[model samples]
Target: MEPVFRPPSEANSYLLPVTTGCSHNDCTYCAMYLAKRFRVRPEKEVLEDLAMAKATLGDVRRVFLLDGDAFVLSARKLLRILAAVRETFPGLQRVGAYINAANVAAKTDDELRDIADAGLTIGYLGLESGDPETVTRIRKGASVDEMVEAVRRAQAAGIRMSVMSLLGMGGREHSLRHARATAAALNRMQPRFAAFLTVTPVEGTVLHEELDEGRFELITPEESLRELREIVLHLELAGSIFRANHASNYLPLKGRFPGDRERLLETIDAALDGRISLKPEYLRGL
Candidate 1:
């Protein structure tokens, strides 16, 4: 793949791979950064890339700080990259990154605040499951409390936050608890958004090994939909935008629930009942 570039804050932003790989890629399910060992791009190299991006792209409204766990970059390194991003992209207004809880934990409140003050508006995380057993089973590397703390600490630092949740993370065994605990955790921080990504086991990931050995059961399409159904029903979001539009999901749904939890749940169920075939699993990123 070619070197990717984007300002610190781009929504639907392109990629700026300051790091080549994920620091903690032990999550059994993901393959996005498995092929490369983790390392930060030299600051000079990152600056040069930013310079090139500035020369080419002019319109910039959203940017997602690329790589799996950009926040894992050293606080000083992150500051420089952010400063470079701001300086290079005159049009940049929104900046976000895909962050993991552990990475976020590495920063002090002051450091996080400084980054946010530098114009990094959003930070995204994957709180895959809130249940301890489920989290351990997948080696997600953060406990429920730790996940909540990550969210709280991020929020405290003045950064708007969004997190992803895997609907069938616990599979059939602990689905309900996963949903309830996850919802409970989200309720604590109630970040700017809650994006739902269905847990689809990709080939060549630890998750597949579990699936192959029958240690884990991939939920049926109907079961996955029902889990989402139960989740949205019980969620007590203040007014978070709930999105189930990721292609891996059983249903594509999106809307704002202004404290109308029941209505949101109903919406999910209705969509499930109405769809004829949510598409073949393979065609659907199955």
Candidate 2:
């Protein structure tokens, strides 16, 4: 079996592998699913796993579908799995999965609603960078407009979104552009949760090759912090939870948007001024 990955916030959730790998695994910087071909697990197997989980860890409150974009599964199949989940763990409070714009576009409005009503409530979207040039270079597999529309449609169907952006995804050339455009996009989407992760070139990925060949220039840690500040300064979220505390971040930041925006900026400024320490290079990871 392929290894599983989940959002940091889902550390306590029971992970259920409904899919083997990412449906669209061509992102330049990602190497998470390179060893596994994308495939939806058999319904029988999925149900059996849920049953085993229930028997082993009774009354799970939260379940996160894995390995990557489990939302790529058809509504019919997902709904069946959700039904089985509810039956197996009557106390299940929420279900979440990695989602992409293309997966959202493939599902009808009604299908999204039905899925939400059945128990799948939150979605994790990797809005790596909103700069069109960066988006193209990364082969993110979805346009900015497509991403905005997809998030909006999912939100309309009652699915709360937790959107993530990469701090240095555009490398040095497009750093500021990436930050500002990403903030603009987040302002438009108004996701329930927003997170920032620094871009790390991974082995076996195009980004790593680009870095090795000098075709890509990763921002310095200070530059990445500036890029993060630019995004935070421009963000116009309404009561959204903002986080930059991922392991990959040089400086950890977390607070509510609009309310804590100013304080967050001050924290960044302090880090910039050397009043607060940044995480060492050796501690950061993807």
Candidate 3:
């Protein structure tokens, strides 16, 4: 089995690998499942794993499906797994999974609604960047329009969308464009949650090769903070929970949208003015 990963917020949830790798794993900056082939585990094996968890852990309130983009599974299969989860845990509160725009787009309204009704209430989506050029350059496999539509479709089906964007994804050339367009996209989607992670090139990825060849230049810490501030400044979310506290970030930030927008901007301004300390470079990670 391949290594599995989940959102930090799901640290206490029971992890269940419904898929082995991302269905669309061609993103230029990602190295998370480069060595693993994408495949949905058999229903029998999945059920058996749930039974084992039930016998040992007794009951779990939350279950997070892994490894990556588990929402790529057919709605029927996911509904079946969710049913088994409810039966095994009985007290399961919610189920979450990593998803991509294509994954959400693949399912119909009825299918998504059925899956959500069966306990799968949340989805983590990687928007990466909303800049058209950046989106194409990264090989994200979905366009900005497709991304917005996917999130809206899922939300309409009662799934809370937690969208993630990557800071410095456009390198030095298009930093500001990336930030402003991303903010515009987020404003349109108005996701329940919005997160920002800085781009850190991994040795095995195409992005690293680009950096090596001098084709890409990562922005300086101050530039990244400026990009972040630009996005926050332009965002028009209603009440989305905003976060930039991932380990990959230089500065940690968290606040609700609209309500805390001013505070967030002030905090970023302080960091830029050297009044606040940023996370050390040596300590950053993906």
Candidate 4:
């Protein structure tokens, strides 16, 4: 099985690999599944893993489907996996999976509702950048409008959505535009949860190659904080929980929308003014 990649919040959940790699692995900045081919794991294998989990862990309240984009599984197959996990662990509260805009659009509203009703309660989506040019340049495979609608459709189907954006995805040249546009898009969708991660160029990624060729420029630490500040400044979220405390972030930030907006901006200001220390580059990771 491929190494499990999961949300930071799913620390206590059981990890189940329904898929071996990302369905769409063409994004320029991502190297997560470079070594693996994409394929849906066999049903028997998935169920056997569930059985083993039950035998060892007794019962789990949450399960995180892996490897990269588990929501790529067909509705029937996903529902079957959810049902099996529920049967194996009667205490299972919710199941979560990594999803993309394409997968969201592929599933019907009824199919999504059925999956959610079956216990797969959350879908983690990497929206990356909301600027059309930036999104296209990164090969994220979804336009800004498509992403917004995908999020809306998924939430309408009863799945709580966790939306993520990258702080330096557009580089210094398009930083402000990317930030403002992403905030605007997120405001329109109003996902249940929001997260921001700083872009870290990994080896073997097109992004890294671009950097090597001097075709891409990464923002400085201060600039990254400024971009983050600009993004938060433009957000008009209703009640979504926000977080920028990921390991990749130079400045850890967490709060709910509309409520902690001012405070987060101030914290960023403090970091900008040298009142707070930023995370060292050596400590950042994907």
Candidate 5:
């Protein structure tokens, strides 16, 4: 089988796996966790991966761990993985992985620091929304407050953070509140890097079914650009790296935030009203 996680951008230069499947896989919009039971691969297996990966690529400077949520590893187990990777590779500069809010809550501050010190310096959290109602609707598990506390705790523990906020996650019924609340969440946590992903439904998922049945109306690629506009305008992040460079983003913009924010938002607005769609405009079609 192919590796379950791929680099989301050009920044990552190595492959690693901290865990497999997603811990909070019940989100209505996701199909990633559909085919498998959620589980963290054993530490010895992961250590062997480190050895194999090093043999494949020497002088690997950065590693991005695979799959939906790597933080599911117990603090001690994660620490062991990071240490082994460093001991084996010796030239790694950074390590990163996706983390869920519940898993963030699972570890104590000291444990987070221990993992960071062992070499995992950055965390990528998918804060799909800050609206409690929206989170419940999708079963994402972490509340707005829980997300805030989680980022705060992880930072206090020395793990620098990045987050993904899904634009248009609220759909037609809740877009404004979604933007405002998501903005509020960012204002509160101010992660080191934050990104806005325009939501695109994938097949074999409840959200795809809803779109198919006309039960939920997705904002058009045009409307998604509009929603992203609102999300960015109200966003008040402090010196964070921001990107909308995912293939899913209509306009693949990337730059330092609280800096190019106005230009980025304006560009999104223009892309929304653009005569032609900014992207391929696949609506999942169920």
Candidate 6:
């Protein structure tokens, strides 16, 4: 199995593959799992992996389930997997997984709570763009409203959500709208962690084809910064930690909501005005 794709913060965590590929793999901008089919590893295989990890690493603090959208597993199966992991690794502290909104909606609130109680603590969700039009164009597979409700329910069930949004997902045409709408959605979801990454159109993705055909226009670097500023200015999150330091981002930014909001905007302004140097295009990556 391919190494689990995870956030920077999860670098030290053990990657346990619960599912292979993404359940919703039609997102136009995504190329992460295009070459693979989505499928859940059987419970026996999951437990075997956990046992192997336990034998190799005596102590494990964090475990991240992979490859993508492992939360799509049924409540019972997830619970069994969580129980096995906890049993195999007595020192386990947190179990995290990628969660798709549709999969989240499939679970009852009680099921979510049960999974959380069983040691699954956090869920990473990709909300590439919150503008309804952009979401539709990208084939994200769920409406903005559906995603909001899904995250809300998961949070209510004690699962801390780490939400991610891509800055240039809407292209030049809907940049401002995407930023504002995304801020609004984040305010409603109030995720524990919110990340911003610049869009990177991979060669085989629909987004790349659209760009090639002149159907979509990529946002300029300055416009991407402006969109970030618009989002920071409008975000009314309670305590969400914001990050824009992805390698794909032209500028790195990190701050807490409301409290460090002004500072974040200032940084963007400095970058926009040439007061601070932006990351060279050569150093940027997806």
Q: Please report how far candidate 5 places residue 160 from its true position, in Å.
A: 2.1
Give me the runs in candidate 4 sitting further than 4 Å from their true place.
none
> Between which residue pairs do clashes occur in model 6?
none
* lDDT for each candidate structure: 0.77, 0.93, 0.93, 0.91, 0.78, 0.91
lDDT (Cα, tens digit) per residue for candidate 2, span 51-150: 8898899899999999889999999999988998888888889999999999999999999999999999999999998898899999999999899999
| CA-RMSD of model 5 | 2.5
Give the TM-scores of the predictions, in the order they appear. Answer: 0.91, 0.98, 0.99, 0.98, 0.91, 0.98
Taking every candidate in turn, the Cα RMSD to the unseen true structure, in Å, is: 2.7, 0.8, 0.8, 0.9, 2.5, 0.9
Tell me which of candidates 2 and 4 scores higher on lDDT. 2
In what order do the candidates fall by lDDT, top score first?
3, 2, 6, 4, 5, 1
Q: Backbone clashes per model, in order?
A: 8, 0, 0, 0, 0, 0
Residue 139, candidate 6: alpha-carbon lDDT: 94
- Report the CA-based lDDT of candidate 2 relative to the real structure: 0.93
What shift in Å separates residue 100 of candidate 6 from its native position after superposition? 0.7
Give a tens-digit lDDT track for model 5, residues 1-286: 2426543652555767666777778889987768867777877788888778878777788887776788777888877777787888788888887877788888988888888888888888878888889888877877889888888888788788888888778998888888888888988998988877777788888888888998777766666776777778887887888877776776677877788888886677667667434656563221
Error of 3 at 193 (Å): 0.5
Superposition TM-score, candidate 4 onto the true structure:
0.98
Residue-level lDDT of model 6, residues 1-286, one tens digit each, is: 6534777778899999989999888999888888889998887888888888888988899999898799999999999889888888888999999998998999999999999999998999999888999999999999999999989999999999999999988899899999999999998999999999999888999999999999989998899999999999999998889999999999999999879998998899999999998898899998
State the lDDT of candidate 4 residue by residue for 21-92, as single tens digits.
Answer: 898999999988999999988999999898888889998999999988899888988888888888998988
Estimate the lDDT of model 1. Answer: 0.77
Q: In candidate 3, which residue ranges exceed 4 Å CA deviation?
A: none
**Candidate 6 TM-score, true structure as reference:** 0.98
Q: Give per-residue CA lDDT, model 3, range 1-286, as digits (tens).
A: 6466788889999999889988888999999999999888998999999989988999999999998899999888898899999999988999999988898888999998999899999999999998989999999999999999999999999999999999999999999999999999999899999999999999999999999999999999999999999999999999899999999999999999889999999999999999999999999988
Q: Please provide the root mean square deviation of candidate 3 (C-alpha atoms, Å).
A: 0.8
Worst 10 residues of 1 by lDDT: 2-11
> How far is 57's C-alpha from truth in model 1 (Å)?
1.6
